[model samples]
Target: MPPLSMPSIPQSAEPAASRHAAPVAKNRRGLETRERVLAVTRGLISAHGYAEVTLDQISAEAGVAKSSLLWHFGSKEMLLAEAATSLFRQIGEELGAEPHHGRTAARRLENSFDRVADYLTANPEAKGVVLALLFSGSVPASVREEIRRGWDSHVQDLVAALSAPGRPLPAPMARLMIATIHGCYCHWYASDRSEPIAAFLAPARELFADWLRSRDR
Candidate 1:
């Protein structure tokens, strides 16, 4: 009774597989749900504009519970911003990854532009989301950084391509060229064309040349 000692219980190690099994399954399910929500959210926002898309609509279109979407993304504004950020990243990757082909470097650059044109034509929302975010300025700071990072990567690819054997393109020139291509897509979109989008590629190189000459000053 003068001194009572308590016994210590040793911890036991459970099987690593057993410990991780449930969590892994849960994580995979969560990721799938999140991706579904994000994809649906981007589609709605791009098609209807950020100001018009709502959480309820996203939930319905994604076939997710509204509560689940709120839990995953917090708010409609946050979801839209995240979606725009994602769309921007996708475009940047496409631009940077477009395969270079043709005998000469200049021809290869033009071929790269061909890929860009195809991408823009196939995914109108890629341009729409960027334009919306640029004009709206409602995207979160973190999302904006993601967008800038993507374009910065794209710039590197363009710079490498443009700085060829005889021709050297400045970073500013690359940026201008990209902007001109974007303008072409915008024009095509504004025209409401039912014809082949590839047709709009006609004057893109000439447009880029005009911009490049003006940039010489």
Candidate 2:
């Protein structure tokens, strides 16, 4: 997959003459405004899928002029792309914060699930946007590809965490584990966050533990 695109303003969007001119520095307030716009975009997109969201809605909610969004992000596509990129980066950071620790692979795997549950609890918007993008047919191909890459990265991380000295965990098994966790998240979100995500993950955790024991025997 291609490297995830960074959220830089496109130079091509600038006037021809201004393209070669020195870039003007943004003041603290200007930076704050840009961040505020991004925050609003993420929240809206998370609450409502990408296709359902519009520049006008984002502008109104963000309290910035529509023209200002164009000035900062160049276009709606760029803004959404940047927002998706930012969300993926945040997920990666949160999941990668500490190595999973346990005496056995099964225990380590459980710890990993706990970490995910904690992350989902702290950032429901993140979970909402992720599920929305994954299941939505209306999401752009570029955005879908970004989500795929992010998902693949998490799968690889789990594979590594579950692997042992002479016993490497199969990628498929790792994917199943991820899918199970995502299923838990899906149920939790579908229920309007009525139950904790950890509650939904409990059965899968037990099932995995049993599977690991069978493999050991």
Candidate 3:
């Protein structure tokens, strides 16, 4: 008798479905956990410096497991970096949305300062973070680098907007214009002012406006 032919074993769709569903489920959980961890980290690190912050503290503050926080950020430095990056990105979005979007370098330059002033007013903790980074030597180099990169990118954008075609201002002067705004904020943060932040920003705004117009001309 001939050997019986073996029947072909067909693959089940169930395994493929399970495999696909597994990653989606995991990713969704991961994103949810990450959001929670970042939320907790921002509150903690903003109120307290990085040195005082720890994974256990974040987990307890966030109501998440320590392992979960670890899975999300891998380390405390990474978490702080994300928070600072988020802050810069928020400011960038507000600045980019201004009437300066399509305007000339001069107008864009003016709007840049105006938008950042508005951001500082709304998010005063941002001022604290800036001061901490500048004055406090304890902040991680990675955090400082992140802020520097953000500042560079923001200046480049203002330059591009201000330097349109034949009317473009010199890069160094444009940078000076941008740096002036940064200096104003830094000074305000450093002062023991009895007045509101708005008061300090008023003169700086006027100065930036005049500088933009004169430089563009």
Candidate 4:
């Protein structure tokens, strides 16, 4: 019987590391490029209005090849829709959940409205998205639908936040109130009026406060 030679210990995973790092680096680059594409799309839509934006422009603004843009998003229309969808999601992210503890719903509503006003005031550039959907109605029906759905969700949250715990306002009035708040926001963006949305909401806020006080009766 002959003794078998001991096998040499395998070296450090440097080869595996080098091989794996390439794909990992490629993935990171892909993610960065994808993010750049979305950012450029958002900015272009924000600045030029969605209807006027083109894939060529988005590609140029993103610094990615136009073919790569197509590879990422398929087409300009899809990219636009996705961009609008993302923007709404971003809005929802900012909204968080309705605060239901400690404070009355009306107070919560007022606080939320203030937050919204501050957001719109600060991001005037994104006002185009709001105005286009609310007033222009010029975007594709699908995009409008997407905005409509997002608006419905946010408004419903407002209604829930404004409702009395067990004695909620009737759906009709709740819907109307939500519309009024949206109208308030639209007025700010569409007309650029400096009436102060926060101030404009004051009367309604007081009305809601009064209603909350009277919920038992």
lDDT for each of the candidates?
0.67, 0.73, 0.65, 0.66
| Model 2 poorest ten-residue lDDT run | 19-28
Per-residue CA lDDT of model 1 for 1-217, tens digit only, reads 6788886654556678978998999999988888788788767765786668888898889899988777877666556656755654555566456554433445555666776766665556666665666556666665556556656766776776555545567788677766777777777888877765567766777566455444433
Where does candidate 3 stray beyond 4 Å?
1-39, 45-54, 61-64, 68-74, 97-107, 130-141, 160-178
| Total clashes for model 2 | 0
Overall local distance difference test of candidate 4: 0.66
**Candidate 3 clash pair list:** 105-162
| Ten contiguous residues with the weakest lDDT in model 1 | 208-217
Ranking by TM-score: 3, 1, 2, 4
Q: State the lDDT at 206 in candidate 2.
A: 85
Q: Which lDDT tens digits does candidate 2 get at residues 1-217?
A: 9999989987678886676455443366687787788788877876786668899999999899999898877767657766755654555455456555545777776776777777667556565566666667776676667667777877777666667667778889878987887788778888977788899999999898778766755
Top lDDT prediction, candidate number: 2
Stretches off by above 4 angstroms in model 2 are: 1-102, 213-217
Candidate 1 lDDT score at position 167: 55
In Å, residue 99's CA in model 3 sits off its true spot by: 5.9
> What lDDT score goes with residue 125 in model 1?
66
Task: Give the candidate order by descending lDDT.
Answer: 2, 1, 4, 3
Give the Cα RMSD of candidate 4.
5.5
Better of 2 and 4 by lDDT: 2
State the displacement of the C-alpha of residue 16, model 4, in Å, after optimal TM-score superposition. 20
List candidate 4 stretches off by more than 4 Å. 1-42, 45-52, 61-99, 125-139, 168-171, 190-196
Residues 1-217 of candidate 4: C-alpha lDDT, one tens digit per residue: 8999997766664677787998999999998888778778877876777778888898787889999887877667656656655554555555456556777765665676677666555444454555455455455665556566766776665556666667665667666766776566666666656676677666776776667666645
